[model samples]
Target chain A: MGEFDLIARYFTRPPRPGGPTLLGVGDDCALVQPSPGHALAISSDMLVEGRHFLSTVAPDRLGHKALAVNLSDLAACGATPLAFTLALALPRADPQWLEPFSRGLLALADAHGCELIGGDTTQGPLNLCITVFGEVPLQQGRSLALLRSGARVGDDLYVSGHLGDARLALEVFRGQLSVPAAVFDAARARMETPTPRVALGQALRGVATAAADISDGLVGDLGHILRRSGVGACIEAEAALSVIAARDALDAEQALGFVLAGGDDYELVFTAPPDARAAVQAASAHSQTPVTRIGRIEADAGWRLVDAQGRALQRQDQAFDHFK
Target chain B: MGEFDLIARYFTRPPRPGGPTLLGVGDDCALVQPSPGHALAISSDMLVEGRHFLSTVAPDRLGHKALAVNLSDLAACGATPLAFTLALALPRADPQWLEPFSRGLLALADAHGCELIGGDTTQGPLNLCITVFGEVPLQQGRSLALLRSGARVGDDLYVSGHLGDARLALEVFRGQLSVPAAVFDAARARMETPTPRVALGQALRGVATAAADISDGLVGDLGHILRRSGVGACIEAEAALSVIAARDALDAEQALGFVLAGGDDYELVFTAPPDARAAVQAASAHSQTPVTRIGRIEADAGWRLVDAQGRALQRQDQAFDHFK
Candidate 1:
């Protein structure tokens, strides 16, 4: 089939009912209007076959993960999902793959009320890139889109939902470790389809001081927030250990390693003042995504690992970098 | 070098002065505030090596063409330039290539008053995907962004700037044809740096009834407008022959072929009612872009080509298709 036919049969859909998309696919460009008194939050992510996903992955899961990663950026900014465009390069147009892939992609989009507005597809090496657009409210003329620069000294550092499971799954995939079948399956699922935590991000909108999604391990992703905010932080091992969701089959050291430096965790790492602790907890409960206090923002310039008693310690975490 | 360091060294520039981007590169997501009463027009295009351009082309030209093609889409919609996101994958992090590549990309962005708000870079095969955002005005309850669905029977078809030079250059690249030194150089330049008619697109805004960009050759791209508008068209061969900007190097048949079916023109093919011919000419003059009336919208459902004597003729023009 031609490129146009491939898109029409598989990807084209009417814009979401009453959604921000004024016009969707089939045009030279898609036209969307952000709500009045709001700004558009945009993010772009590119995923290559071997770099971001294994060749063995199911197409549906790959589709879900592709959009999920971009959504995580929107989640970090506490923006409500609006729509996304996908630019895909494939070796060929295989119907068996396209069927489930679109199903998985649109399914998550529907769950988040995000519309698949427009995109391009071509025959080439397998690569997927998604650029997501979201809306953030304006507060007294200031956009409420959270940035990593808003953290202040002595603010309580928090992380939403769980982390480490996805990284642990990678270890198993690499044959560095093995786990029980159930644990392995669950960890693989986490790796393949990590939740985006969009609701939690929105709930913490005005309540949290600063935020970032944990994609390249807790310490590394947290480093982004610290560098942008020009502050340091301290992570307590005990608190961080509790943030690992798939720890039933792993020992304490392995779990700590995964929690500290393992990448692919799509949870939010945020900061809020001590006085807003109650408010933070309220947002957590409201969004139904658990929040953990694992670190504290500091006036110093570099992060540190601490024990349960708050004594500084050495680390085993290594953040993921595409070009190292 | 790591990914973050690479981005920091080469790509982390601030948003344009007084531009719409409230927050730019450093954040998890870029935040841009569109003017009130305007909608954002977004387009995404992917370029894979060996498919979109030759490997021998300079990095700077490739960079310019990447953004230029996307801008062509915005022009088709009559959208004003805005901030864009770039998602790139490279085989390696070579500064030698990146330095010149970024220079070409940003130079065009500055010229158009468009900002490179944010993007992602990863290690993979060479690929560039750009998601561009533009703004279109609203009139009453309707958006002024032109659509392919708006073409009506009896509308006069128009095209902005020139066409077919890019296709002629491709023929030379494939060793299917040869030309004089000056002709080859001019055609190659047109192929590499085809201008995006942004000003002309915006000027034609309310004047043009329907529009589309010529990427997959004139016939193929115009076919899109015809299908979307549920109307047919008739191309006058004589008027089309005038669109061959690089025709000095070729015979009449070859020039007509390139003009009729050559892809990568990056020009606007649009329609205006007969009564609005003066307005169309005014827009062309105002934007300093020449336009040619080559065809007319028809009541039927398929297109036809007629000779200068107004008689139907056989053809040799064939549109470019990736799969075919």
Candidate 2:
């Protein structure tokens, strides 16, 4: 199929009745209603083959992960998914790929009540870019969207959802590590179909002082929170190590490394006042997402990894830098 | 530099005071305030190496054209530019390319008063995907955003700015055509930085019945309007042939093919009732954009190319289709 035909066949749909989309696909631009008393939270992510995903990945999984990564950004900001535009460039139009990809993409979008509004499709190298629009409710005089700058000294730091499995999956894929079939299957699933903590983000809006999605490893992503908030942190390595879902399949060092510096974890690392502990727990419970307190915000300006005995182990401010 | 450092050095800026952005760039998602009573017009365009643009084009021009294409969509919808998010994938973080690219991009953004809110930068094949947000005024419960479906029978079809030069430039680049030094330079400039008619689009808000940006040639992009509006059109061959800016550089047949089927014009094709000719002319004059009335919407169902004597010539619905 041609460019327009591909878009029409796989992406275009009638806008839902009374939906936020006043004008959708087939127009030069799509018109979407911005919710009153709310700010629009926007984020864009582009996934490229061999860099963002492996060539062996199923198209359906690639589609799911593409939207999932962008949704993770909205979840980090406590925004409700509203709509998204996809700009896709393919080497060629293949029905086998488009059919499953659209099905997987639309299924997740439907589950979140997020509409696929409009986008551009063309023939080029395989690249999928999604720009997501979400609504972040604004309170009387302030935006309630959780920000990395909201963390304060003495605030408790917590992480939601299991970590390290996605990285473990990568290690396995690279033939760097060997694991049982069950463990490999679970890790692969975590890598391919991460669950964005959207509900948990909304629940923690007023509860968490600061939030950031952990895509670029705990150390690197949490450093963003620290740098923005002008605060430091010390995480008990044992606490982090305990949260690695695939810990049983690896050594202590592997677990610690993957949990601390492994990228591709779409969990939320957040901070909350000690007094809001109960609320944080309630939010975690309400969202059905598990949480573990790993550390506390400090007055200083760097991250320290401490052992169970309170001895400093490693100090790191590194993430997976594409250039480096 | 690493991803974050690259972003901070080139892309990050302080939010404009009292601007639409509440949060920008550093966060996982940027928060923007939407104009009350107005619908947000959104469009995305992606440029891939050797596809949307040539590898030999200067980085600065690439940046300008990248954002220009998206702004063209907003212009077609009569939306006022607000902000945009850019998602870029680069082969590497080279300061040489980035410096000029960011400079050109931000320069045009500043000219349009559009903020660079947030985006993603990654390591991959050179790809740039930009999502632009614009605002269309709401009037008496109706969006003033021009839509392709609004055209009616007896409406005069108008085209804004120049045409064919970009295609001529392409032909010269491919060694398929030869032209004088001045002609080649002029055509190259038109190909590289054809201005988006944003001011004219906004001025035609209630005046024009329908509008579309010409990206995929006049025949293809105009076909979009016709199909959406359920109308046909008849264009005088002499009129379209007259608007070719580089006509002096080529034969009549070459000029016709380039004007009718050349893509990447970045101009607007619009329609309005013949009685509103005065308003259309006033808008064109007010915006300082020259427009030529080349066709008229008809009761019939397909576009016809007719000669000066009203003799039907070519009945074409052809446009560049990458996959075809």
Candidate 3:
């Protein structure tokens, strides 16, 4: 089938009733009305075949992950999901591939109330690019944007859900490590279909001082917040190690490394003032997403890891860099 | 440089002083505010190396064309450009290529007041995907969207600027044809940097009944309007032949083929009531974009071409299909 035919059969859907979307697919452009008194949040992410995923990945999972990553960005900004566009380039149009891919994509979109707007499908190497649009209250009063630059000294740093499982799954996929079947299955789920903490982000809208999604490891991603906020951080290594799902499966050193620098967790790492600790806990409870206080923002210059006794710890791991 | 560094050096810029952009680069997501009473118009396009352009095309031109194509989609909908996000995957980080590419991209963006909001950079085979946002008035009273389905049974069909020059340039690049140096230069300019009819589209907002951008040749793209509007059209072959820049350079058959099915013109093919001829002419003059009246919409079902003597012309040339 031709490109247009393929899109019509798989990706096109009727516009859902009562939302921002005015016109959906099949037009030169999709029309959407932003929620009144809200600013639109936009983000784009691209995933290349071999670089971003293994060839053995299911098309359905790849589709989910593609949109999930972009939504993760929206979550970091504490925005409500509105809609998204997908630009997909495939080497060939196979029904087996297109069907499951669209099903996975639409399922996630429906779950988040994010509609497929408009995109182009082309014939080339496998690449999926998604641009998501969302909305956030404009009059939040005091810049409740959850900006990377908002963390102040002495704020408590918290992370939603567990970490390091996605990286553990990667290690198993690479044949670098082995684990029990149940552990492997859990890690594999985390790696393939990450749950973007959208509700938690919106719940923490005015609660978190600064926030970022853990894509390139907690230490690296939190470092971005520190640099932007012009502050330092002290991450308790023991607290971090306790949050790793595979902590018992690996040695302390390896588990610590994965917990600090392993990537693809898609959980929110946020900061809040000590005075707002109760409110932060309430947000976690409201969203039903677990939170772990693992660090504190510092007035000093760079990030440092500390043990339970407050002694500095040494580490030799780096965040994932596409070009590196 | 790493992916972030590459983006910081090339694509990132301080948010422009005044526009819809509330926040730009360096964040997980960018923020924009739509006009108070307008709906957002969104579209995306992907350019894959080898499939979309030759490796020999200048990086600068490639950058301009990448965003230009998406802008063309906005123009087709009578929307004013607002901002855009770019998702790029490159084979390697080379300053020599990025410098010119950014210059070309930002130049066009500035020309249309479109800001670079947020995007991702990755290492892979070269691919550029752009999603552009635009705005159109929500209360135009009579569907001033210029939708492809709004054409009436009796309307004058019009097209902006010249056609077939890009295809001529492609043929020259493929070594299938040759032209004078001056002619070649002009065709190359049209092929590499065809002007999107943005102003003309806005000018025709209320004047034209329906419109579409001519991307995949006149006939094929016009076929989209026909199918969407549930109507047909008959083109005056002589009038179409008159608008092709290389009409005198090739045989009648070859010239007709290019004019009918040559893609990448980036011009607008629109329809308006015969009674609105004066308003259409005024729009053309106001936008300073030359236009040609080539045919009329019909009540019947398929498109046909007639010679100066009203004799039906026969030719076989399909539009450029990515899969085919």
Candidate 4:
């Protein structure tokens, strides 16, 4: 089928009557209505073949990860999914590839009540670009928006879910490491379909001072929150290492490196007032997503990792730099 | 600079207080507050190196056209520009290229009051994916949104601005034709930096029954409107030829082919009631964009081109298809 025909047959769907979407695909533009008194949260992300994923990766998994990464951005801002547009450039019109990709993409979208509103398909190297729109309700006499610059000194730093599994999967894929078959499967799933903490993020509204989604490793991503908030952090090495799913699978040194600097973890790293610890725990319980306090926001100007004995640990790895 | 630093230096901007944008760059997601009681119009377009434009094209013009094509989609829906996100992939971080690109992009955005909200910058083959957000106000108790399916039998079909110049420029670039230096320059400008016709579209809101932007040529794009509206049209060949800026430079048949089936025009082709002709004219006058009555919508299900004496014109070229 041609580009337009392919979209019409697979991606286009009738807009749900009385839904936020007034118009969907098959037009010059898609129309949506933002809920009254709510601000729309928008983010865009692009994934290129080789750079973002392997050619042998399942199309469905690739599709899921593509949208999930963008949704993770919204999650960091405490917004609920609304709709998204996918601009896909494919080498050819292969139904085998297209079907599974759309299935994986829409399945996740359906789970979050996010609809595929509109997009464009073209001929090029395999590249997926998604722009997701979300709704953030106004609360507490201000928009209940979590920002990178909102973290304060003395705030307790927390992270959602286990870290390092996705990176472990990458190491396996790169043939640099080997793991038990079951462990590899679990880690691969984490890499392919890392869940966006949307529910937990919404629950943290009015609770967390600042938040960010971990994509480029915990330390590097957290550094964004620190740089923006003008705060420092002292991460408890043991606490951080405990959150790695493969903590017991690797040596202490290797575990520490992956826990702190391994990337592709879509968990939430946030901070809240020390007094709101119970409230933060309640949010975690409500969302059913595990949370652990790993560090403290500080007035000092740089971040460091400290061992259980309170000695600073040597840093070895840097964040993934796309341009580098 | 790295990807993040490149974004911060070139595209990031401070949010305007009390503007529609609640939060701009530097956040996980940009937050925008759509005007109350209006529907958001969103569209995405991607431009890839070698496929969409020549590498020799000016970076500034390339940037303007990238966003302009998306804005043209909004214009087709009669929506006012609001904000846009740019996801750009480049081979390397070259400040010389980025400065002009962002300058051109932001200048057009600033012209239409659209803000650069948020996006991603990565290292890869040069590609630009832009998702633009627009607002369409409700009118006459309905959303006042224009749709391709809204055309009716006997409606007067109109086109905004001149046509075929962009195609002519492409021909020259491909070494298929030559023109006077002045004509080449004008046509190249049209090809590289075609205006989106935003004002004209907003003005035709209540007057036009349906609208679409001419991107892939007059016949092919209007075919989309016809297919969706379940209507047909007989375009006047003489009138179509008249709109080609390079008409005098080519044979009648060649000019007709370019005017009817050439791509990259970026003009608006809309249908309106016969009684709304004056209103359409007024809209054109108000927007300072020319409008030409080129045909009439019909109940039949196929399109045709007729000469001034009412003889059917022979079809020559097909619309530009990316894959084919």
> What TM-score does candidate 4 reach?
0.98
Candidate 2 ranges beyond 4 A from true positions: A315-317, B315-317
| Candidate 4 lDDT over residue span A208-281, tens digit each | 99999988888888989999999999999999988988777788888888878888888999999999999999
Per-residue lDDT of B208 in model 2? 97
Q: Name the candidate, 1 or 3, with the larger lDDT value.
A: 1
Report the error of model 2 at residue B156, Å.
0.2
Ranking by DockQ: 2, 3, 1, 4
Looking at candidate 4 chain B, the ten consecutive residues that score lowest on lDDT are: B138-147
Best by TM-score: 2
lDDT of 3 at A97: 95
Name the top lDDT candidate: 2
Per-model DockQ: 0.85, 0.88, 0.86, 0.81
Q: Model 3 off-target regions past 4 Å?
A: A140-144, B140-143
Give the Cα error of residue B284 in candidate 4, in Å: 0.5
* Candidate 4: pairs in clash: none
Candidate 3 chain A has its poorest 10 consecutive residues by lDDT at A138-147
lDDT of 4 by residue, B117-231 (tens): 9998877888899999999996643577778989999999899998899989999999999999999999999999999999998998989999999998898899999999999
